[model samples]
Target: MLYQLNQLRDLSSLFTRKEVKRWLKDDFKSIDIKLERYNLHKKNKGSNYLKFLKETYKILEENYPNEYILKNEFLNKWLKSELGNQNSLIINEFRTGKAIADLAMFNGVSKAFEIKTILDKEYRLSNQISEYKKIFNELYIIIPKIQINKYINYDDCIGIITYDSEVKNFELIKKAVKNEEIDSNTLIEILHTKEYLEIVYKYYGHLPEMSVFTQYEVCKNLLSKIPNQELNSLFLQIIKKRKVNNLFFNKVNNEFNQICLSLNLKDSEKNELIKKLKTNIN
Candidate 1:
């Protein structure tokens, strides 16, 4: 049953250690093991099942490449290696207007990574990229080695990245061209309702008076009046200050660093996982 859970983790395309823990807890409950006992077992640090879970995940990761999961994992590691401790925000399933970006990072520049596995199709790719271009200054299509040929020019992808199974890292197959367009409308749309109002207040010193229903449209239009460069600077400032109160067990879980600031154990867990990953990759 334990190994089966690990199997399901990869097969699901997007699985996290957090979800696995929940599933494990449920399984233990079904087996009549109390949650307190399980917690106590971990507190005591001689958990054979916990050790088994780590070993099982390690073995599966080495033998099987679960397209999106491992690809995302490698990208996170690579980003950490490249970006280090720079002020940055990584968002998973980042929504810009009507489109949802697979992975997005905000730092020196706004960039997004759209992943396409062997099984994934190019059907909605045009629409996806069109929407991504609205806000993202850089866009990349991450695809497995097998699907690289199919996506080279699949739209106006700024770059293409592939997972090198042997090296266990993402290698850029094509350099992403920097996008000069910074769509303020899309950028304002990405902000929460309160944030939209806040930025507007910060810029012009007062909220635009409008009915409750017209507030969004009025706010968006007001935000558009700011020059793109100044708006870009404000966007960067606000996003960086976003508090990291959430917890993340998955080092690549998008909220990794933010949550790591509050949870030291999460940092250790991420380090341990990355350590094991390095060992296995080598």
Candidate 2:
């Protein structure tokens, strides 16, 4: 059964980073074998590639839903739920320190969510949570209902949310408390050299002279002197400046919401995907 589920999870390859780039570039032929292998290429009334993808997604959601599907649900549900606001930016695979958060949301503040599915192991979770705590203002661990007992006794600050496959919605089992101890170094690691330099210039009114070789170290030393609270806010501002297609993100079909947001699509790419998805599959 597990093997079958893993096989079904392969359907997600259509949304993989490489494939998404290819799709944006109008390289649809690359996906032909898998579509034909799964018999998803057969002509159907009123079905285009987008509809085909939606149908494929349904099959995975109903059968072998994996981590990406779980993230898709989280993005679709909470992005507009009471939890999210008008300015909310949903980030996928957000890297902080040594851990890559499953999903991170930037609205009024930064929040990180780590998901553990039935197929996942708990070995690295402790380390991941430890890393997340240093940067995010609030943190939550999303898990399957059967695994609740395994994590229910964790630190009080870490919230627990459970997934109900039947209704396909997430329910908050425990509310996460705000963590104020933001690690400046970890937060700085999230930024590119240019972004961190920009932050330094904004806060100090001028950047110190340093060679490209020594600029990173110099900036790190300078940024470390700033208060963690102030730095955390600055980090939020820097990350939020990244381009996420709000127009298409909110307007696209729910089925495409995850990939749309995850891909960090440019305005032209967004238009390209919309047209590409509309192209009929024969």
Candidate 3:
């Protein structure tokens, strides 16, 4: 059973670092900031955080014994299976972290497994890879399929796994795994495209309902951290068509006032820009 468990772990590690890098680049921003902040805090806190993680790992090892898997896998499989199966799995075994390794089985052989989610620089899989190697010859890092190439020496690993809901081509994932280098930036862009598109879609028809205030606030906060021109362009494009409601009008007005006060912009220049925007809207 331990050997079988190790096999599953090896197969799962086929997800290369390059692939994980790509996924994080694209989708990292889409993750709830509060959760990210908490993870970051945990990572920075050192041994206490490691202890918590180790406890979680210990729980999985204790409960499943032979069928250990990650939370994301359980969620993915549960979503894809029949509704009844989903309910049964969730109610009876999912929460307990024990499920028969149906997917990890081939013929009569079963493999060991390890699952991971939300890869970041601080709590990255790289840190855990060695430990996983010690326990199982095979290790898997389940991530979005779009990032499969990010994994280094994937061909040498057992296999790359992803959620069924992912739209990436399996062949592409296999091919990427063979490559030597993976561009994390490109991967992140791909992962977050859906999130950006969703925000755009929500405000498409109801521009007036668009939360310009929040947009501006986020932009202002992020401006120091991001390229100024790119940030400005993104902000302008998203809020360009949005009608100035009370919140929108007040936010913009406040921003304009703050900018005027902080910079060399005269009241006349500020008013000119406002007039131009109003004219364009009318």
Candidate 4:
């Protein structure tokens, strides 16, 4: 059962459209099926399960719009029309070597658009903004009205596009980044600031208590920000608390180790880290 839970957690983070399609093809509908069953149950336990599934789906949709469409036919149609092979818009293009802009518009001149479904008032779209300016003549971060106040001035290059029930309207705001834009070093500093880290820590620090699938989701987001060293420390903390059993811990640890190896961590370092972890757990 624990093994299955671990697998479900890993699968939930498979967010790209391609990944979700493959998941559906593989007869892996347990999460959705279980969610439906739970909704039908009258017990509070069932209610909690439904709530968790809804939250998980919400997070997935916000982070991976393309993937979300695989489960909802209406969304697929909407996105296809919005991003069709119109000469005005190019969908899913690799703008910079590092980032993929959700949609790029080349109307007469090069204009880039990064679509973000969820917006936090405090969190700035730093990476998307940097990539857009570096690659295109103009750039906009499209988000909902719920996040308008998060940004001070949206008149410059940083514009906000609000979505109605049916259509989206684009607003041309001022440029968010100036001639002396925030550099990579500065951006990293800001991300690591107490304010930013606090938000991240609040979201991720209590992850061990969450379901295995929930832990995986939180870890996926955390891996984007926290360094490998910090991740290793957190994993150790969870293990020491016996928050997850040995089998589950090993599974997640192996995944993290594989990610580190893919990032070109030296073979010796990889072996050393694995050895240390095994020794500590034993």
Candidate 5:
């Protein structure tokens, strides 16, 4: 049973459009195999597919340590509770410089979160935090309660958020100080070409006049001339403009918020997913 549940530990399959379609079409062959092996078929009898998924997730949370569980919990506590009504954008696996942030939240300011599960090693943690510090206004590392001591002597500028499975909640063990020394070059590198171009146009009052091949370098040079503080504000403003409709926040279950929001699903796909969650499975 443990092995079977471990196989589904990622819980990524439940978020994909292809998998959602297959399940909605009543194609349970693959799922049935795993459930049967885990001896959950009889225990999950008559529940809708969504209910079964929730139950499976609950079981997994109690039995295993995984990053997705941490992501979902953070989304619930930070995204929903703190910035629920704010004009914020939560990005998963956000790339900046040599590191990819586990989660990045943008509102009027930028915040990066690096998740460290008990199952993970701290081999590249320093590198990841160094990269994030260059681009984000605030930084946080989310870790399991048991691993708190490992980060006890870490920098106080970076916050520590701990997930205690006992209460299924995230606590801010340390408050992060806002990073005032953002690297303009690193920040600009992470922006989409169009976003940086817009920023250039915003500050310079005109877009750079360069060939397509040279536009990147030309714009980068122009953006680099702006004061760091102003450039950072512009970056946040442009990112927050990449909006997710409120329908997603209102319709999807909070547990699925991180994946669903990051998926950038079409309106039709979101509607289909919302409808399918209520679907019954024998």
Candidate 6:
């Protein structure tokens, strides 16, 4: 693994000098990391993010063999870099009531990504697929190359993104079919409490005189009553607005990205890291 040294010039805005030093020390320990020192003096030699990322990814995948390697190298880090980070909102381990999704993205339309690593089994996919359908306008199941044929035999509607470790990259094997049956319930579920209330208040009126305890219930009920086209329009509008107002969520998101970047995401370390990142940033 090697780095051009100016990697953190842009990202340093999201982290303090001390944290940046620690992070670069840990995440880039094995690599020639010059990002922090190069950017400290406010001079950017201008590194190509994708090319260096590909080089590091190639090193990690070839050297470290783990069932979850695809997740860190391809699904989380490389994919975001490839997508150009165009102010999109991405959530991992997204939950809606009982069901949890592997990854969810909000851009123009909500998209869900379900990852089934090379070591994972596909037996429980039916229930998850059903749940995701109720919420996401577009759904994709990401699987290792070995699981492609098996997953393809199960369904054709959901898109298939496959990972090939040989090349250490993702291959879009099949484009997902557009989900025509977009549910209004899922649209409301994705919105925050403030967003839901704002939409309802703007469209309907003052809350229907309910207890504050039940405001969520009332707002959800009100949202369900909105016609599909109107409700969907509101959902997209709020998503776009929130993407621009991502300052509120910047710290937490950057922590998750840091975890993936560092490649030391132990289960026990996740909560502590998030807490520390939040505390330090705030």
Tell me the TM-score of each prediction against the true structure: 0.70, 0.87, 0.23, 0.37, 0.87, 0.61
C-alpha positional error of residue 159 in candidate 3 after TM-score superposition, expressed in Å: 2.3
TM-score of predicted structure 1: 0.70
lDDT by residue (tens digit), candidate 4, 1-282:
122444344435533334323333443344445434434233333234324433454443334333222223221233234432333423244345456655543333444556555423423467657655543555656555455665547445564544332233434334433222213222233222333334356546743354544644444455456553453333223223311111111232333321332233444544554443232110
| TM-score between model 3 and native | 0.23
| Cα lDDT tens digits for candidate 2, 167-258 | 88888999899987877677668888888998899889999999999988888888889887778778788888887664324545666666
Better of 4 and 6 by lDDT: 6
lDDT of 1 at 153: 77
Can you list the residue pairs that collide in candidate 1? none
The best candidate in terms of lDDT: 2
After best superposition, candidate 4 residue 66: deviation in angstroms?
Answer: 11
Cα shift from native, residue 125, model 5 (Å) = 0.8
For each candidate, the alpha-carbon lDDT, in order, equals: 0.61, 0.78, 0.31, 0.40, 0.75, 0.58
Candidate 5 per-residue C-alpha lDDT over 108-134 given as tens digits, one digit per residue, 9 for 90 to 100: 778898999888999898899899989
TM-score of 6: 0.61
lDDT of 5: 0.75
Query: How many pairs collide in each candidate, listed in order?
Result: 0, 0, 26, 8, 0, 2
lDDT of candidate model 6 versus the reference = 0.58
Model 2 whole-model lDDT (C-alpha atoms): 0.78
Better of 2 and 6 by TM-score: 2
**After aligning candidate 4 to the native by TM-score, how far in Å is the CA of 259 from where it should be?**
24
lDDT, model 3, position 139: 38
lDDT of 3 at 73: 30
lDDT by residue for model 3 (1-282), tens: 132444334333322233223333433221123225334344433333223333333433333322223333333333224112211211111010122222221111112233433232324444454333322223344544434556535436544555332332112122111112222222123223333433344434222243644643332233334443343334334332332211111233432222232232445555554443232110
Stronger candidate by lDDT (1 vs 3): 1
Off by more than 4 A, model 3 = 1-112, 116-119, 152-155, 164-282
